[model samples]
Target chain A: MSFVQNFPFFSIILAMFSGIVSSVLSGKKARNLSLAMIVVTTALSAGTLAFCLKTGESYTYMMGHFPAPWGNEIRAGVLEGVTAVLFGVVMFLSVAGGMTHTAEDVEDSKLNLFYIMIDLMLSSLLALVYTNDLFTAYVFVEINTIAGCGLIMIRQKGRSMSAAIRYMIMSQLGSGLFLIGLSLLYDVTGHLLMSPAKESVELLVDSGSYRLPLLVIMAVVSVGLAIKSGLYPFHYWIPDTYGYATPTGSAVLSGLVSKGYIFLLIKIFYRVIGYENLVGAQMINVLYLFGVAGMVMGSVHAIQETDTRRMIAYSSVAQIGYIYMGIGLGTTAGMVAAVFHIFSHSATKALLFISAVGLYEVSGDRKDFVSLRGAAYRNPLAGIGFAIGALSMVGFPMLSGFISKLLFATSAFDSPSKMLPTLFVLAVSTTLNAIYFLRLVITLYSRRREGDKPLPPNPVKKSSRGLKFAIVCFIGLNLVLGMASQPIVQAITDGLAMFE
Target chain B: MDVSLVEHLLLNIEETVSIVLFGIGFTILLLHRNLIKKIMGMNIMDTATYLFLASKGYITGRAVPIVVDGIQDVSAYINPVPSGLVLTGIVVSVSTTALMLALTIRLYERYHSLDLDEILILAKEEEQI
Candidate 1:
């Protein structure tokens, strides 16, 4: 009832409020305001996480004094709190990390618009993470999608325009399906909040009324989110969209944007549908099969890519596969692995994209892997950052990816029937990951052979000191996450235990 | 055995009609070749979805959800939640339509054509160059 209990409420409202203010300002002022807003959000969310840990209680804050059934609400548990902090950190770093790229890539006149869209996107991501009401989630999801399209086409270049169109078409289809699914759900349960919906769904299932329709809705919602998140079979728009966007766009779209939807999916499965019914509906099997296929096929596609950014995009599809595979395992530990992978993938991919921009600048602005022969020699900071990201992606020991992969493998162990196939695909994906990422690492460090294009007469200007500091933080976080896995994993498991 | 199912679904003309509209809109969005046509299809799909949702909240003879004095029975009013949701959906769809048109205009400016295949071919040709 006090001010502190409303941390989740104010955190979301503050971000959304900043987004509105951001739209009216010049680009420079907007960036300053956004930075201040993000820092405040990060601090507040971290406070919320600490408070939740101390109290060991999850509570819901109702909107505008309306009761739960009538008005919207936000649930603040340790899981939601931690995810909000992650969203803040990633958004903050993404803009800070690619500051120069944004300046260079966006038209000077339209820079204000870019910052506005980024702020809106951040607010939407935070809202998506915190909102307890399904309809609120849908509204923010659209806001996120529109802001995403703006980020992609801020260039107004031919390639980015085409990419934006494709991205919008695919995303619109996904949201449309999501809307239909939510309509069916509301019709069935007559409740929009997760707990009441879960109760109604359980009763409906128990009585076996319209069981087939319920099953179909589950599949529809699952596939809808899968498509939007660029999981396999729905990832056709990903490489073009990520590859063509500016570095900051690439980082935010691939890293932070995708995770919000995945977070929603996890919440849906764990809280709204009830995990028992979710597993019983056989949706996980479909997700499992596609995830395995994505693991292999995504890597293969990455290997064939000529451009570095597109390769990273394809690799993202593969990483998403690992996350989905964990979710589809249908165990609490598995869900933790999936969520852990979400964090690791987000941090590592954003770092990779920003570093790739640094590599591009010194390589005569060529994004091709061949042109990056001696990038490290010119800019050791980006080179080292890229190496850290590559190592993590390949699941080297003592990194975040390894822990997520290990959690995934161990989690699958509980289901003996699924153990071998899951382990096999994971093992194969690891090898495939090494093949592409190590090749790039070797290319970065490889000597500038004579026949290759000469290094630019002068090295491109080094990235701003702020960007370097964020990269250092990224490396340190990845290393610390790897070394200190026990507390975090235990925390994740504990947080998930309190879900719903 | 299936009599009740058919009556519940097929006899509900509003639901069936809206669903049919959704299917048609989806087909147009997916299979159409023109950029403007795709936007139209998207609008149609939005309309269909709103119709479906609005129809879901309807009652046979219920009044509007506004409460007048002495109307104490909850059953006297239709559900208002779906209409509220559909209003938000309409706003989102309108914004989407506007963005799509802007994008289409940009594409038309670049390639001088509205056909999606023609634009794709032009893009591929440009890439080769």
Candidate 2:
């Protein structure tokens, strides 16, 4: 095996190890160690991406001495490599950008615990991306959920504490459903490894045996993942969970954590149960229906939201709706668009959260629309960052959101039955997206009223060079995703082609 | 409704029982107003899943999975994978239960109520104040 092939395994193990080591260290040391580990993993994943692109194939690595059927395995392809790299970049930016808030919001004693959770969260995300074993994916899903709950409650407020419990309950319910579904799948297929299971599933489908069981399994697994990712009907916990957490927590949870679950669902659809079978089961129709509902209702909720952070959180519901809509289109091109939307949404949402923090800082840590007026004048970089993120989310030309939107529109033509509803929702959702995001932008830049009382003097004047750097990099990342989307989409197409 | 369906259900009594238990646990989880009861409901749901998995691994007149005295035949043992999965599921459930209980403790300290609705109201009142 080439040395580059070891990168995925090494990165996952390194992240888990660092998480363990950080638990006992001081808070500052843990933070530094976590940052260093993120940088190293990003480089490693970039190397893997380059190697995979050159090889133009997927390779599976055994976790131990045993081979695939009897042992755990992780597979890496163009899709996994690109996703890992994107996750690493987004995570680093989110953590670095929200560093000031982390220091202030979390108490001194439990700070190292925060870094520990972050490290574990990253490890879980990477494992979810590369895992070829269904059981291993379930284990990592639990890790991600627990660590995410810890991140929410680490801020040590009553609101955050309560939100954590609500999050935990919903998440546990999702996992329980997922576990039951997985057990049923294993019972039917007699294999836990994805490839072997896929073979068994194909045989069963061809023989027309176990049809009802197969359909039930697909619905159960899809609903489990949909609930976890906060698709329309089950997203009641999002506003409080995202709105009350620390800035980094909000960014990472909304940007990467939910996307991880969706990626796993995509893998299950393509790799485990074959997309054609899923379509036959009519699960895609259900997803498409919910996706359309979520698109309109999420935006409507956002319009009704009074708080700025909560508004952004509601927008996330809408963005997730768009991704599911793409997936529900049930074509290769549609899946490609869905995957690309994952990337664009991650970049733009993380940027918005981090920049919103900067705005909050200038406005004396209040997130209300009234207090945010003219706050951008004090922090021009943050103001500009917010503008770029908002505009990208609004699907402006030469922005990442626009590219994904275009991909969705073009791909919708492939399916005649889904075409009209897809286009109609696209038009309606885009208008709704514009109304809320642009309103926030205007609120940020609007001048303070002459009759309003003067704001309190700013307290701490610490230099936020790290925050500025992260914002600039995020903006650059968004632009690159928008302008150079062709290659990435091609990469995703190649990756999905190799998926089976 | 049909005789053959009843016969099949009876033959797979363990699976039927487990499914019924799962339904009960899920309903309790959804309907309970107290935080402790909700956690209890979650644990019950987890236990039902473990029961289901364990039933799948067991076979009639089969020995435990371990090899006994140079007997390496596959027929000598029940399927071992489901048992292993059940063990892992138990560990995860324990940890999740512990985490949920800890959060409940904190919430009680803050609101002095074990009822979710009461706590939510108290929290909103605190926010306004």
Candidate 3:
């Protein structure tokens, strides 16, 4: 294939190298270099997406030009195409937001390391999504985790340090379990590729001896990934880290990093396990149960949270649960809904985080609902962004979240199992979403008293080209893409067809 | 001496011993209270993985995985892939250990104790902020 064909992967490597070079440069120079890197990467990703659409053919690029099965391979099929596009969108938005906010926070002393780690994290994410080899996927997972940990700890703040340490411990445990599960498959099949190992496992499914090992392996793998993905019981660390990290860093984590593992989970459970196997067994039911539980539990917790970032973090857990439920439904429609939710959530959530930065920049403190009483009136652009994002998250019709919810609800009702309990929980949670998010929306848009605390000095000027471009581009996506939801849904359906 | 029988017995013994070692390490990791000891258990489990990988590539009377001039060639060499992977794994484990140690030191500095309970209390206090 031509270099253009492999541009996505190449762009990532170049970005990381550029970041490393920029890190060593002076602060002002580094800012310019990071902005340049962001532009180049955003262009490359957008170009690759365009190419994929033009070709309408799935492409696989093997590392070192080695063939598949023996060597690692990166496959960019329909699902990857849609995800890559969404990834690019979020990345552009994040970089845009960061270009202004981060340039000011990143001192010359720490600039190089930050850029390098960011590049590594981004590259690893791309690799994780594209690679078909489970072992190679694990390597990418490590790189992502380490880079993430490094990002969080770059500041020696007590909370950042502790949170980073906790994340590192949890990640290591998850990685170990994941590696063990991979080893079990490798032992049985002598192959590291996902497809063949899955096929070989199916042949041994009937053997009682393999059942325990398989269950153990699945438990290990699922729990590990669930922790990483912030599924219900494993989601404790998310708010702590996201709440403390600079807004830009949190955006990357919630928008891109978590999605990486989540995509892998959807692929593994639905594709590798065979939908028949999953639906026939109790696994699907179990998944649905956990998902609904997370939905209810997360929403309830979010309702109680007053911290803006913490509230968003809780909402993420609940949102992930929604994605889980769609996947658990184990139908073509369900997978489509899940992927749709992923795309919509990535856009809306990034929009929210970026807006949160804008609000933080203006008001200086993001601690409580009372502090943000007239924020909407203060910055109309950020106010509308927040409102649209909140409404979309609540799954209001004509918005992106509505489609995902409708698909999920339809899939649940259509299943032979007819999981009414999960359906009820989902409805309740959506209502609860209105309770929390609407509170913020109303608080922002409401009238302020005459004696209300005066607005804090706006530290961030709305002048950076990258930030303006990122926010405007994402908001445009929210408006334009929300109307054209069918094509995105169709893309997801095509991607999920592999699982079927 | 019954050389063939001895070799067979030793091979079985190696497998059994390595499995036992892994099990013990895991048990300690699950049951331990001290965080440092838990890390020690993790190291032990890693050592078992190293042993298992090396064992997978072993053969009776085989030469080490080395490339030399013409004389040392031919069919007497062991599989090099597992050994090579094990080396990579070792380096990764070392990095993990270093990070773990750094974290432990930081925890010590914060709470002035290695006890998880005290650390949990400190974490809770920090959380209320």
Give DockQ per model, in order: 0.62, 0.74, 0.25
TM-score per model over all chains: 0.97, 0.98, 0.88
- Flag regions of model 3 displaced more than 4 Å: A1-4, A45-55, A104-106, A206-209, A270-272, A449-469, A498-500, B1-63, B67-79, B103-129
Residue ranges of candidate 2 with Cα displaced over 4 Å:
A457-463
Can you write out model 1's per-residue Cα lDDT over A309-331, one digit (the tens) per residue? 89999999999899889888878
Clashes within 3 Å, all models in order: 0, 0, 1
lDDT of 2 by residue, A386-433 (tens): 999999988999999999999999999999999999999999999999
Candidate order by lDDT, decreasing, is 2, 1, 3
The digit string of per-residue lDDT tens for model 3 on B7-119 reads 86686786556656766766655556576876787777767766766776677788886767555665779877567667866777787778777877887798787665467
Per-residue error (Å), model 3, residue B102? 3.6
> In CAPRI terms, where does candidate 2 land?
medium
**Residue A201 lDDT in candidate 1:** 93
Cα displacement (Å) at residue B18, model 1: 2.0
For model 3, the local distance difference test gives 0.73
DockQ of 2: 0.74
The residue-by-residue lDDT of candidate 1 on B1-129, one tens digit each, is 689987887778887888788778777877798888888888887898899889999998999998777797898999999999999999999999899899999999999999877876787678657
